[model samples]
Target chain A: MLSIKNISKIYKGSNKGISNLSLELHQGDICAFIGANGAGKTTTIKSIVGIHPFDKGEVTLFGTNLQANPAHFKSMIGYSPDTPALYPNMTGKAYLELIASLYEIDEGERNKNLAYLLKELTFETAVHELISSYSHGMKQRLVLISLLMHNPKLIILDEPFVGLDPNATRFLIDEMKSRASEGVIILYSTHVLEVAEKVCNKLVIFHKGEVVVNDTMEHILQKASLDEIFRDVTSDD
Target chain B: MTKLTLLFLFRLQNQLQLANLNSSNKDVRRHAFYTISGYIVAFLMFLGYVLFISIDLNIDNNIQAFFVLISSILFWAFGIWDILSGPDDLIKSKDRDFIFSLPLKTWQAKLLPLFSKYLIHIGLTFIVLMFGYLVTIAYIDHFFLAILFVLVLSLIIPLLSTNVTFLLAWVVRHVLSIIKWRNHVTESIITLGLFVAPLIYLIRSSASVDYKEWFIQASILRYPLNEINSFSFMQHIILLIGITAVTTSLVILLLTAFHHLVSSQNAVQSKKRRTNAIWHTHIPVTALLLKEFKLYFSSLTYVSNTILTPVAMIALNICILVGVIPNLHSFSYDVAGFTITAQHLFTFIMFTCVMLTTTTSCSLSFEGRRIWIMLTAPVSLIKIAASKMAVNILLFLPGIVLTAVVYAAIFQVRMLDLITIVALLFFSLLLISIVGFFINLHFPSYTWNNDMEVVKQSKATIITAIISMITIPAIIAVVYTGNLYLLLLIMGIEIAAIIVLLQKISCNNMMLN
Candidate 1:
């Protein structure tokens, strides 16, 4: 289980940040965080992944506190940022291998996972080229492969579908569903409400750095479409 | 505003990061202030050094013409080095597609980057020429003539240098286009040449020639400086007009070639598929070390800036051993009342080289926006910092060992003296590596537009350099006290304390803004 309790993060010299944001995801739960721009989606994800520190809250992964045991806590999570920022000088293969080493995956397992992911993502041939030559979609696919090769317990992706093709996006949704079935908790933020409404089991809508709705996706969608729901909840802000 | 003016303003603002200086956030504003202040301090120090050198030249023999000749040679060498090191930014900017998409003429787009480059060169040349003006006034005692000379030289020098650099870049790019694997081959060849040329020049000059006399007599700037010193007003005007005409023609030629270069750059070559490659895994720290090494060598700017000092140390050691330079064993200098030997000077140079050649100062900032990888990984911050320092050590270790062996062979001192010297050097190396890493941790900048900003201009780099400069003399003084063992013990304890402190800091503050 992943639990974030009353986490608050305010940027220095600015009032724009997540405030008293709280959420929880049990095993086998796929949660979608939907929000407008600057609605604090990325901030909350970053805090949970231990990339940004929260001012007043506690985050724990399966009873392991992030502040007390960061290495172990981070070991159980895989994170992909909204935009993939990769080393241009490194070949795709080298970058993936480096990630695998950092996550301490065995060599045989790493090679097997990489082979499967590369072929499934349609990036087998271009993996030998330098990342500087890769298109945006290719870079996104590489980031996805790196995140999945380690087989973490909790997976977090921020805007992972922006640059992906339709086929890759479908593969990603299917992969999330299959992994969730194996008791891996998945959390991702997106502006694509239609896809989120179809794929996610749980829905969390953020409005002005505060969570306005946290419930099952089915419960929220029974009233109106996600598009209308998001507009109605965030209209005041 | 005209399109060209708007483009120039955009590039200038990006290069200077002016928006950050005017940011609404207090922390951002403060950080920008400190960084800009650091640059101002560095510039002033450079200007002061040039002025002092000019004054010294005057005192020696009133050789103001020699100073002008030397400065011109420096300007020329820098122009050539600039071209040989990297691609012309005008032709290869990252925002090429966006800028070209705008409603603008091709000539306006091409002229923007060239104008930016000119601004930088003009700023640098102005500093050097200010010293030239002062020297001229001291020698000729004519303010108006000195002003005329400075004005004319400033206008013509940057124009000439920029043209020459563009022409050379065009020629080199065309030559590299024909080679297979151009990027890798070009970087390696240029890096090798940059490293080797100075060594050969120093060795040859030390072995055979009186360098100062040869330089003054053989330099192409001698006649120009003489003509200016004679205050031949019409001749100066003619020379300026001639250089202007040539540079204008060169600019036209470059503008015509711009489209062809841009199109050729877009032509992609097919790469061979490596389908059956074996994958290797290592411990996380070793993996990080390998990554750091790749990053250090991948860019010519990084390698050339950090590696040159260590290479100079090795070259100097070879020179001393081969008797091309003075024999350090028998030489001694009486400083104040203490007698310092050539061996001391040799050790001092080695220590200074180690201090100057640290890649740790810029390694963290060099990651730029990709620092998210390090932050999100399961590895501890200590491990990441260690990998950076380890690369610095590995780079310096070979040169350090070579110098130690040469020192032992040349001095033939007792075993205890040799042990003391080696211990001092090793501890100093550890000290600098840790200090550099720690300093960078506090002053990291991940928003740099180019490697030069982080590697050469960032506050972390400047602070690390200042600390190294201060430590070099202090270490030398401690060694001069005949208590090398005491100094070694102190340095070891200091390193231990810093490591403990760094671990604490890293654990508490791992997130970068």
Candidate 2:
């Protein structure tokens, strides 16, 4: 289980971050965080993944406090940022290998997982080329491969579908579903409400750095479509 | 304003970092202050040195011609590297595509970079000519004529030099294009040659040239005074016109070439195919170290800038051993009644060179936008720091050990002295590495458009260099008593204190963001 209790993060010299955010996810849960731009979706995800320290909060992954043992907390989680900021000088294979080494995965196991993921994602030929040469979609696929190769308990993705093609996006959704079925928790932020409404079991909608809606997808969708609910909740008037 | 003028102003503002001067953040303002102050102080010092040299030379007349010759030679000697390495700036600017897409004429687009290059040459030429004018006004009776001569020469010199440099760069690029090699490989070879050529010239010339005679002969005021005096106004005008014609022709050629080059497709070479897909695993630190090494070697700018000092130190040691240079053993200095030999000087030089080789200073900044990789990795900051320091140490260790062996072999020193020298050097390396990493953590820059900005101009690198500049001479002066054991003990204690302090800082500041 992953739990974030009352996390508040305000960027220095600015009041533009999440405030008093709380969320909990048990095993086999797939939660979607939907928000408008600058609505604190990335900030909350970053805070939970230990990328940014919250002003006040406690994040525990599998009973390990993030502040107390960051390395252990981070080891149990896989994160992929929105922009896919990878080393351009490194080849795709080398970058994935680096991630494997960081997570202390066995060489044989890493290779096996990578081979399967590469084929599934249809990036086998491009894996040998430098990341500098990869298109946006290819780089996104590489990041996805790196995130899944470690088999972490909690997976957090920020806008993972931004540059992906339709086929890759489908593959990602299926992969998330398969992983969640195997007792892994998945949390992702997205602007695509249609996709989020279809794949997620739980929904959290943020507006102006505060959570406006937090409930099960089955309960929230009974009243209106996700598009209608998102527009209605996030409207300034 | 016209679009071209707006573009130029934008580029200038970005290059000068003018926005930082007005930044709301106090730290940004302070950093801008320091950077601007550092440049002003360096420029004034250089101007002062030139004025002193001119006064010391004490020429009576023909000062304008004499200084012109000196300035011409200086420009050719130093300007070659700028020209050879400057094409990258023109063609590889981050905004090249964005700017090219705008509604601008082809001539305007070509003129922008040429104008920038010309401005740099003008700055160099102005400094040299300003001193010449000062000397001429003081010495010559025809003051207004001298002023006219200096003004005309300054304008003509930069124009001619800029055109010549661009022409040469065009030729080199065309040749390289024909060869069709990788850009990085070609750049590395050229950068290395630029560094090594001067060292080779110095070594080869030290034996053949007589210092006093060459200086006297080269200064036209001292030799062939009659011919210098006879260099009249008509001759100067003819020379200027000839240069202007040549420069105009070269500018036309340069514009044509720029248009062609910009239109041509950039060839992308495929990397060599790998036979196997398996990757070997290692401990985290070892993997980090291997990654650091690969990064250091991949960029020409990083390798050339950080590796030159160590390479020079090693080369100096070899030269001394081979008798290419005079033995330092005979030179001695007395400080507070204690005699310091050239061996101490050698040690000081080695320490200074090692101090300049702090790759850790910019290693973190070089990660730039990719710092997310390191920040998100399941490793402690201390371990990442250690890996960076390890790469730094490994880069200079072989040179340090080779110098130790050569020093001992030459001096036939006692075992105690050998131990003290080795310890002092090793401690100095550790001290610089830790301090560099600490400074980087405090002032990291992750938003740079060019690698040179982070590697050469970032706050971390500049601050570390300033610290080294102060620490090296201060340490040498304090330990002028020629007490080797005392130096070793002092350095060891300093290193220990720094390690403790870094530990404290790291506890409070673990995340780079």
Give the Cα lDDT of each candidate.
0.76, 0.74
lDDT digits (tens) for residues B202-274 of candidate 2: 5456544433233333321222212333557457557765866787566666565656554242423435546
Model 1 root mean square deviation, Cα atoms: 3.6
Candidate No. with top DockQ = 1
Candidates 1 onward: DockQ, in order: 0.66, 0.59
After TM-score superposition, what is the CA distance of residue B427 in candidate 1 from its true location, in Å? 2.0
Misplaced by over 4 Å in model 2 are B22-30, B59-87, B141-145, B152-270, B273-275, B331-341, B505-509
lDDT per residue for candidate 1 within A40-149, as digits (tens), equals 99999989988788899999999999988888988899899998989988889889889988999987788788889989998887888888888888999999999999
**DockQ for the candidate 1 complex?**
0.66
Proportion of true contacts reproduced by candidate 2: 0.53
Instruction: Assess candidate 2 and give its lDDT.
Output: 0.74
Tens digits of per-residue lDDT, candidate 1, B1-513, equal: 987777777767666666678889887677678777776776687677666656656666746555455555555555655643454365656567767788887766656566777777777777778766665554655567667666666656677766755565555445565564445335434545543354346545654443444444433244433355464645656775596668757776666565565435424432433554777778999999999987877665677577766667767777777877655567788879888888777878888888775578888989988888988899898898889988888877777777877767887767787777777787778777778777888888887767777777777888888889887888888776758576776677757866776767576558854
* Every model: Cα RMSD to truth: 3.6, 4.0
Q: What is the TM-score of chain B alone in each candidate?
A: 0.82, 0.81
